[model samples]
Target chain A: MSFSSTDTYIVSNALQLAVDAAVALEKPLLLKGEPGTGKTRLAQELARSMDTELLHWSIKSTTKAQQGLYEYDAVSRLRDSQLGSDKVHDIANYIKPGKLWQAFTAKQRPVLLIDEVDKADIEFPNDLLHELDQMAFHVYETGETVTAQQRPIVIITSNNEKALPDAFLRRCFFHFIEFPDEQTLRQIIEVHYPNIQQQLVTEALDLFVQIRELPRLKKKPSTSELLDWLKLLLLDPPKPGQLREWMSDEQRQSLYGALLKHEEDFPQLRYLRQG
Target chain B: MFIGLLQLLKRYGVAVSITELLDLLAAVNKGLAGYSIESFYYLARTILVKDEGLFDRFDQAFYAYLQALDEVDISERIPNEWLSDPLVRQLGQLDEEVLKQYESLEQLLEQFKQRLEEQQERHQGGSKWIGTGGTSPFGAYGYHPGGIRLGQASNRQFSASKVLDKRQFADLDRDAPLQQRGFQVALRKLRAFARSGAATELDLDATIKATGKQGGLLDLQWRPERHNATNVLILFDVGGSMDSYIEQVEQLFSAASDEFKNLQTFYFHNCVYEAVWPSAARRGEVAIPTGDLVQRFGSDYKLIFVGDATMGPYEILYPGGSVEHWNEEPGAEWLNRLTHHFSKAVWLNPQPQQRWRYYPSINIIQELMQERMFPLTLNGIEQAIEKL
Candidate 1:
């Protein structure tokens, strides 16, 4: 069969190939893209299609590799020990299994998503090298090695916040979700809003394309933003030339807030309007 | 077949492990990757190719390996001579009948499609064939209302909607232009201090002092927060008008790399479009969204924009002014966003201060920077550092 799996995410041929390759290799698929490019949604869709449980690990600035493996509740254990509780006798009772640990211990192969891995410190990816490579980690406190029942399909996403270490990069397959081309964007919009008027979609798309090409806007409207704008447009449809001529300057500038995310971008809409 | 392909990829500098190779084979056997050549290529690349940076090298290897194994060469996939330039033969004048027939864009496109199939040999300055510098419906540097350009270096005319080029940012020479000592002297002015962060290391002094006050009792103390570390965000403009300043800019970049511990560098061409790349070669394939970048780097980052600030006024004032891509927001909007986020910011221009008045874009940038623009000279560097 062709690589394009029947999914609502509308995976392009290139993306489909990348997915197939990652699946075939049993390596983690490393996705790098701008915000609102559907990196996280792709993982969710892939898991749904493959009939696997989704195990998500949303990384934060303070997120550490040890937290992904297993968190030792030493403070809780100490409190329990002082209280003379039965749970205080065993360290394993207080061990909270992390996302990776849970994925590894699952009976079936799970889709483990490490979302926004770049949010963590530079050393975060490197820290996961051992466990990701070996597919097992020793619970030193419990003296038990937690090994994978089946190799879980891993999907890692990044917003390109930080450059991942070369050592960490070498273990995974990489794919970049580029800004969707016109045709792809059209298809995406259609998928999300099936019954929307064709004229509105066309106008909004054209206006979006024009706004994105504005020379001075800091934050260009992304795919998600485009969808949101389209939803807004559907509420009160603009006249045929309303985007260019009909709407008042204030109204036009206020409406531009949907497409241009930055505060600095609002003033620049006047220049774009002149064009 | 898979092993041979892997060997070929290895020869071409695409590192693939034995386990990855095995996985590719397994994928093919299980029908996860289809039987088509296209599917196989993608499968092999996804499994074997680890780094996104090595994608161009992988493509070259894949094309070479495919050509060697099969008698048929897929020239379309590879960057060959056909994609380089139009054949140099000249058919100076436009044929009246041909001109009439190709009056509309649709007619010209139709003829261009026919020419793509019929014309195998390279030709230039011809009305009928797909060649350069002619009234032809196809190829670059030709006079056409709407033509299909196969391969061209720079888009002088805004006629062609499609473009194909294999140039990458990493291929550019990154050697320092200035003397090592000179660079060091210029870079010393940058002040860096680690202040706030999650406490990891133990503060022995604090721990000991606290223990003495507690009558010899044990007191564990974490390291002082270093979260408010001095961070520097460098936006280095490459290509187009900035070509002359490459050497000096490279020196500054080298100096900054050596001097700053918290340096975050990104590469842009002409202007910071919607996104920027770490390397030139990977620019087309990989880019960090400019918006995400603003959100990622905090307000404390010292933003140093390095560029000539010399370009067509359209590039700054109008949409679709960028030479490389049709950027939605003008370059000025992005620059302003960056400046707003980074209170401490400066634009270092390599073009001598004397030439500043000549370029309108320079004036526009200066105004945008609120007169923070400075030259790349030693004196200029000192002034810029002082401001920072």
Candidate 2:
């Protein structure tokens, strides 16, 4: 319990509290954040921490709540019926149990990651209200009610693409993952690159922050991008003596693509550097 | 104590359901929350608050409840009074110096720490002390190249390297009775409906036809709901000249945020520049580039410019014209880019149309806007929305 590689999840006080609240209340933890802020990663970390099986359900725009509950393969059933197969007689044979059904029937409580719940329409969350509330859903084709043997530790994430209904929101404990500060970011870097040079990390963080603060940057470099940039910097490590002076504009510009995703920001970045 | 807190929240129209209350009590009983006010606050909020929209109302109620017990506390922040004395802040002849002594952030923090120890009392309008209206590497309302702002409200120069205070949203008057019905009506006209999103609603006619084709076999069909698909990119001109119309602008902000489904608001000063802030608190901290807005949002988005459009003619025409920052490009170029990118755009000038002729800058903006500039009056907004 004291030591494990699975505990690589750097539990900030805020994150710990959020996890604690969600676990204690047995409610779905709704995590909202900007892209690459570790919303999906948090679910995996939670599962690893709890020593539970992780069940990921990546949501697409076309994803529906009904698909999560159950999908009736009527075409297969109709074809089988036309073929005069014995399997067609039983509707349960054609009933495909969805991720929710699998989670409900799991032997132990599993961590269900409903990744990018906002990618789906506004009604997506609303449609799952009954199943989420009761931890159960009905299979109309088979006339069977699928109830949870052990309620899954549900972690739903959203990028706030669209406004979720008020009713759907009330069911879960919400947590907004703000961009990590310098201290937390350092720990995060340490988690990824354990034996990285301190001066390099400091200088990289400094320049990274400066670029983020540049007025009217189209896309600020995210946590993942910072980590990715750090990896690139670590490859060709700068001299310890030259750490005081930031990388030259030309040198920086070569690696600038990682920091600034948008081409429009390149000109602004130059302006910031000069002024 | 918990019940009293719940009651207070209810009184503030937070709509905390009975089940949520019971769940909160259950959590307390289970020893989930530590014997701390903050832990209790988080736990209660997590249980009670259902929607993000109610977060403001919940925060207000929580503060009011805490205030009753004389335990109201602001988040831990660098002392504001230690930095500035706002009363004595002289507008004229403000010291403008670029403090680049600290080469790096670590060095800056070290200097700040040393200064924090040496200074015993508050000082204002000084070059040395971490006070306002000075060239110190700390505090706001001062000119410091890459300084950490202690408090002093929103950033003016966009030079504060970092802000220490926990950012808070401006308390919107949501409960205030809608005094302007015409304004709301005008905003409603901006709605453009489309069935573009994921299929969420049952297409009854399609389902029926599918069922008939399948010879009595139940077939289901889903079609996306018809929603207000109009994308609105609203750029609000804040600070200088626009200060008088804060109340009016706020009303418009509130109405637009409520009415439009896909509304994106950005703040600029006087005219469109290279960048715009998402909020006033984050003005200096981060700026989303105007180019990014053009790239992010398509030409379909109705670009609505909310500003007085009244500034020096040089401000719009000449580069480095902006009083705050030395904008590399002229304001007119950016406005032209915005108009070109967005086929549907209108400038909502808070200034009266009659007074527009007096201001040369307004006339310049009108020409760039293709004479699509309208007054902030109800009728003017109606005409603008109709044109959109």
Candidate 3:
């Protein structure tokens, strides 16, 4: 199904407040929520709404602060300097701007989405805080401070793994996005994957609501998972002769992972597997 | 308009009865409209004052709102009043009961000791156990005729000549504790900094004045001295689940307390919400009054929140999930306020590096912290201290 602006649902007043702040303050909005709460997709939607370039930075545990700003191309610089030492005197010429710097210097204000910031080290957040605070960063090699011509709207996402320092939080407006309710989740599924039967949609949402209440699950199934499940059911609708064929084995296994996380939860999934 | 006036009074932290709220609301030009202004006034007043009956009604209304919004059903209980007289009385009674039980336990222990001594005497063959292997005067099991071994033959006895020479064993002093080494290194660095004159500028005016007293002839030699005024706010997580990592955390807490000037410590569990008390034992004692807290310490202090952020994610999302007390807002709100007040802040997590990813609550906190949470390693602590 083709997506539209009206299709997007804003559940909480807090989220609306955050969006308003982002617009008023002209600052990067930082979103914190659970894993399946559509934090990354919000950035995509925001980019679509503003008609801006969405520069995505998927943060990992090993992500470094310097990597976000600039990278040093030492190999090429070393070759040139060695081949022609007298000609290539300026050693600082090897620095190349990374995603953050590129977005800052872009002609249009890009949505710089720093996804899963909690995965990055403490230094990374500290580094970003300074940049966010001043809207500028200094390149030691160039001996010049590069300021943003147009401040890129930055969105940081985290599934609270560790307690972030308060100093860094003060720099940005914060918002928590919770999981959508059953009605909203159903609407999302129907809007995203239209071919699914209404009955199937209702049944899936009912099952999802029930499953979410189960304490053993690690991460609740998100909107994306709901759509995925519907797509699978539509591709191979349940039949008396081939009830087992309704969900592909691979899809079924992956679905279980999304639904069940604990050993005790396996027994609860017997009904789903039986059909 | 009357309801609005009542709300104003409530906001001003006034304790108004239901009738008073209605009267105040009625006094205003805008009297009770079609809606139950009296009811709404009472509801809002009870919510503000946190009256149990009113609070329950407010909670029901909140739940209804959540239901309408299609949010998850959050089944949580409102925290009991920490300052309730009944609760305090019950705690005192419990303490008294515990003391009485301890005394009874001591008496039982003495009786057990007496029985043990009698058994030992009987085992040593006190003239009556030679004929039969029956129950002796001690009223115990089989015994040795003359206790198993006597004098030099006893394994328990250690003679001075039999003691092992210390020189033959490995020298334990050579391998000192890591904490000692770290302390020594820190001391050495402090001494070096002292010697290098990386301190306050000398008081030239005072020196010149002193020299003038000696007929303008220079008698005093000028040297810079260190003006060490390090202000530290160490927010330690104590009580509840924090009991597990008390030893290591205590070490760090003590170290920071000794090293920094103006070092203040407060106890919190999981995450800080609203206010933190000075002592964990008397969290509800009102030791640091709310007014005093806000006045004495604002945002200028450097805050260090020490805890393992292993809590239900709802603790930050919901108001009532906190362990110590029910906060009106989520823990994040308090954290945000703290950040606004403190120029520098850092979180120290004792949980190891590998396990942080598994906990959603910790992940959420880390994000709130702007990814400023660091593992509580030796190097991490040092870096944190240096940053402070």
Candidate 4:
């Protein structure tokens, strides 16, 4: 069971090996990288390629580890009991299943994506360590151990917001996804915009890579930003000129909104040559 | 089991444990790496090394182990009987890096002793003697990280172990270019969450009690959402010696803005004399007096001071010792005043922690801050946050 690049998503050689090892070892693959290296998109592509379910649990600052397992709606149950509703009798009705539960009981082995794991509290990963290792969690209310019928492939992404706990890191097969190079970037562009002219992509990518390499950029434009910039470029394409001369002020500076995310970087545009 | 490789990794301070080695063995048993050493290398890396920061060390260790195996000469080989023992094979290699470490250490200590004998007063520049910003391999601010750095006790026993233990990766990465991401991550630990925002979340416990008291009638309750209520007051020492740390201080400034909602920053020179300005642009203008600042921010705010803290002892002790203007009170008085108001206060010194004791001004301020001065690194920030 090897993961290959899909029509939409591209997997580098290193990432492929990491995913394979994690899947084989039955360990969660902890992915870390810059914001837009497509760490979240890997799980989506993997599920699509495998013809399986993709269970995405998007984490937030307020998110708790308990929410991933299950949430008991005691307030709803109490309200139903007050109204004398028949739903109050069954406690299981109020025990709403979370992303983990759904993944656990799925007929087919799913790809469970715990996106932005670092956004939550520091103790979040530590709380889920046992469940992740055992592939089971005990429901105190239901008095039942919810064990995974088929262990799903888990992929967790972190924006490097906080340093993860060591014990949690020890259990994971870690892989850092670096920004794709020119060759890979070109391939990514081709896959996304099949009808786009090759010359235009080559020219745009050359300028993009140069812009990225410039020092003191607060936020380097990633692949997603490039795609957006390209999309905007496609609608009203820049006029054809010499390789360096083609990208004049009117063509580049006017589209600064799509490329340069920060106001400080607008001044950095002056450092770039027309070529 | 690659016991030799594991030992080599540990010797290089990679911190590879038995559990990680077992994980590597498990991967090998599952035929993850068939016949290719490259596959095995990747497999071992993915299993053993847990951080990207240690990648450079592991890369060197892994190659060194492989080279040791290949470079085993028949002439230098140990007896056939002892060769079978992994520990014997590992020790028999006699790594060149180990020899180089020992050689450099001896050379460093010998030179350091000679320099100490020649030096008299505190030296700053020039290549010779124990000083700063020179090609000298004996003291602080020298480009060499592996040099023997003697703090105040140059006559104390010069340990070769301390000199050999210095690996340049961590220091190099932090010193090459300052990143705000590291500061932001460190500052995140100083969180004090309080329910301060609008009442968006449902107060379930209160609702249930309210409903029960109302004769089984349903009554809903609402409460404010939790927000980070950590108020931070940062005083940055600008100009002179602090110019070297401007990049780091500025990065911290930006990161602080991103992390805290109630952050107040002020600029001071050398030390906080009587008043601190609001910004570095208009430094001559005093925005707020140091006395009023104590009452304005209150004790609830966590006070942070960013500076190199390298100045004359008189500047902190005497009233007329300020470089810019004559003052009624010394800078030490202002620091005491601030710390008295804000119980949770910490001074972040950009100067390396090892060199802190050499500066008398730093010692005076440290005593004034009650030993709350911390180095402005990730580990230092974590410790500071814990104290706060």
Whose lDDT is greatest here?
Answer: 4
DockQ for each model: 0.29, 0.29, 0.01, 0.28
**Tens-digit lDDT string for candidate 1 (A1-275):** 23353535677666887877677567889997667888999889888887779999999977999999998865566457556789878888999999999999998888999999977777799999999998999999989999999889899998764557777877887787767766678889888888877776776677677778786454678898888877877677777655555334556556667777888776766655442
Let me know the DockQ for model 3.
0.01
Better of 1 and 3 by TM-score: 1
Task: Give model 3's TM-score for chain A to 2 decimal places.
Answer: 0.84
TM for candidate 2 is 0.61
By summed lDDT, the worst window of 10 consecutive residues in model 3 chain B runs over B81-90
Chain A TM-scores, candidates in order:
0.94, 0.92, 0.84, 0.95
Candidate 3 ranges beyond 4 A from true positions: A1-13, A85-87, A239-258, A261-265, A270-275, B1-388
- Report the error of model 4 at residue B372, Å: 3.5
Error of 2 at B64 (Å): 4.4
Task: Give the TM-score comparing model 3 with the true structure, all chains together.
Answer: 0.42
Candidate 4 has which clashing residue pairs, if any?
A244-A275
Work out the TM-score per prediction: 0.60, 0.61, 0.42, 0.80
Give the winner by TM-score: 1 or 2: 2
Candidate 4 lDDT at B196 equals 83
Q: Over the stretch B173-229, how does candidate 3's per-residue lDDT look in tens digits?
A: 222221422332231221112222453444556656775687655444456654334
Q: Model 1, which residues run further than 4 Å from truth?
A: A1-7, A246-249, A267-275, B2-19, B51-53, B68-128, B131-223, B226-388
Winner by DockQ between candidate 4 and candidate 1? 1
What does each candidate score in C-alpha RMSD? Answer: 14.9, 13.8, 29.5, 11.9
